[model samples]
Target: MGHPLLRRRLLLSLPLAAATAGGLGFYILLERARQGTYNPQTFSNPLVGHRVPDFRLVGIDGKHGFGSSQLIASKKPILLNFFASWCVPCAGEAPYLDVISKSGVDIWGIAYQDKAKALAFYLAKYGDPYTRLATDPTGRTAINFGVYGVPESFLIAPGGIVRWHIAGPLVPPIINEQLRPELQKIA
Candidate 1:
């Protein structure tokens, strides 16, 4: 048997270990809160009201795809979305995106930080609503668009100007009320 003092010390250490664990959990929660709340005015590229960045990426069909110039050439408004299979918000917004695409808008999708197979699985399951799907293997295209996370969307005018940007998951109301009107104004 252990000494009585040693037994008491071991018993007391249980509460200390729990307290340490609790403290660590609380600290992690606080850090997450801070990160979530830290929204900056300027995105990486500050694309709003600026010309859309030129990029060429791989399409879902494994073809070389391009943005910006193609939209300008087509003389139509463009909706660009940054998404990834692993992003929950992106999945949440998928149905709304499908609706928008079906409405005849020139919608394009950029798969950010995602593998082709995963992107294919997501599209297969959720239905591909994009007129074109550009794969950004390294997420460099997302950085150009000032994207902090997946499910970020941009409305570009016929002149290739980025008119509006929405972060996070999108809903039908947001699309109809805010995004559609903004696109009309730019168009």
Candidate 2:
């Protein structure tokens, strides 16, 4: 048997060793994140490469509603954006959406649990860039689309196949680097 003092010392050192290893691992992750080489929000979407979920949403603020059939019938790819009037990031992406729309990309906006008046005000404040607008009052449609949160977007190719998805706001970098390249592949 080992000496009692040695055994006690060894047992005490084990916790310190574990703590040191854990701290090192956490530090490495933080460094990677700071270096822009790691994305904590990176995740895979099972819906990608599959058809968009079937849904029928009512129109918001007198805009025409949309359904899966419309997406499937589209002649070209479309960007389906799930946003809310209350979302700050959604507002931040508004200008980019307008620019993208002006560039001839189709964007369909879905308001998630937002009131008509608020949605109208939001659209008025931020230029309306959506070709069509729908309301998911119960957020059931968003649930079906595997939406993690508001301001998510899906790129649906002709026939309603979801080619790509982003779980965050569509900022300039994402639009230029990732979204445009993916659209080119389908185009």
Candidate 3:
């Protein structure tokens, strides 16, 4: 038989155990609700305000590649877009990116781990907005920029400094309100 003191202690701990369990359950429920309510798709990149390493980019031609100097020598700011043919959001943002390019913004497209043929098809369907295009077949460039997903854009200054980074689709409002002002400054 258990001692009376031990029995009493066990009974006293029951309420504390129940309270702890209830608190943990509540936390889990709140977390689930929070995640469900938010997009949860975007990631904040830590590379903002830093200079990206210079690398060669093949100018939409798989055979011939160009160095980073060509892009850096430009006076205007460059929009470096990382996208994949398989990403649905990339399709959604394609038109906006085209519009940005047409507005005299230099957009450099990096095909993130995508096949060149599929990339051509996607560009043909969505409209090619890139001033210069390249492919990152191994996603090494994406990893360097801390890209966890597709449809990420980095606004790079002429000196190769990464000024701003956006993680999702480049919608019209974002273009008009946020990007335009910053671009004006750089211009």
Candidate 4:
């Protein structure tokens, strides 16, 4: 058997080894990004420019539901936002989304892997900006949209085709520079 001191030393090295591995992983990611070859797992949606998948999800309100048609038939451009109550960036981006909704844009919020009670509480806390909110607790719909993370959004044109996709929170610059210009075309 090993000496007791040797066993203790080995045990104590576990955390150091784990930390070194984690640091090395991060450094590799950084170097990859610096080389301009970094494609984040969430960097692009394969569903972009494709027809939205048909899905019928019940709303948190318990009164209505929505599907791809709701997004496709909008007179104005529709923004389909995928979020979860548990997501931090979703919370941070909520207010701006509310503002966008109020500016005559149609927004359909998809609750990815979230429960109804939590969604109600989240909306009550953050403000409900969704024209209609649909629950995707099973993550089936998220897969159809090529969503790997929360706070992703798709701009669907009037003909049911996805125009552009944003795989992050709706910041002001993105809203202005990317979204607004595209919205104008569909307007």
Q: Pick the lDDT winner.
A: 2
Which stretches of candidate 1 lie above 4 Å from their native place?
Answer: 1-45
How far in Å is the alpha carbon of 87 misplaced in model 1? 1.0
Better of 1 and 2 by TM-score: 2
TM-score of every prediction relative to native: 0.73, 0.80, 0.74, 0.76
lDDT of 1 by residue, 1-187 (tens): 7899999999999999999999998888777445442234435347788888887787766676766678666678888888889989888888888888888887888888888788889989988888877888898878777887788888888778888887766676578767889977865
Instruction: Provide the lowest-lDDT 10-residue window in model 4.
Output: 33-42
Please report the TM-score between candidate 2 and the true structure: 0.80
- With a 3 Å backbone cut-off (N, CA, C), the pairs that clash in candidate 4 are none
Please report the candidate that would top TM-score against the real structure: 2
Candidate 3 lDDT over residue span 135-176, tens digit each = 888887788889888988889888777788888788876777
Candidates 3 and 4 compared: the better one by TM-score is 4
Positional deviation of residue 138's Cα in model 1 after best superposition, in angstroms: 0.6
Instruction: For residue 156, give model 4's deviation from the true position in Å.
Output: 0.6
lDDT winner, 1 or 3: 3
Per-model clash counts, in order, read: 0, 0, 0, 0
lDDT of each: 0.79, 0.90, 0.80, 0.86
RMSD of 1: 11.4
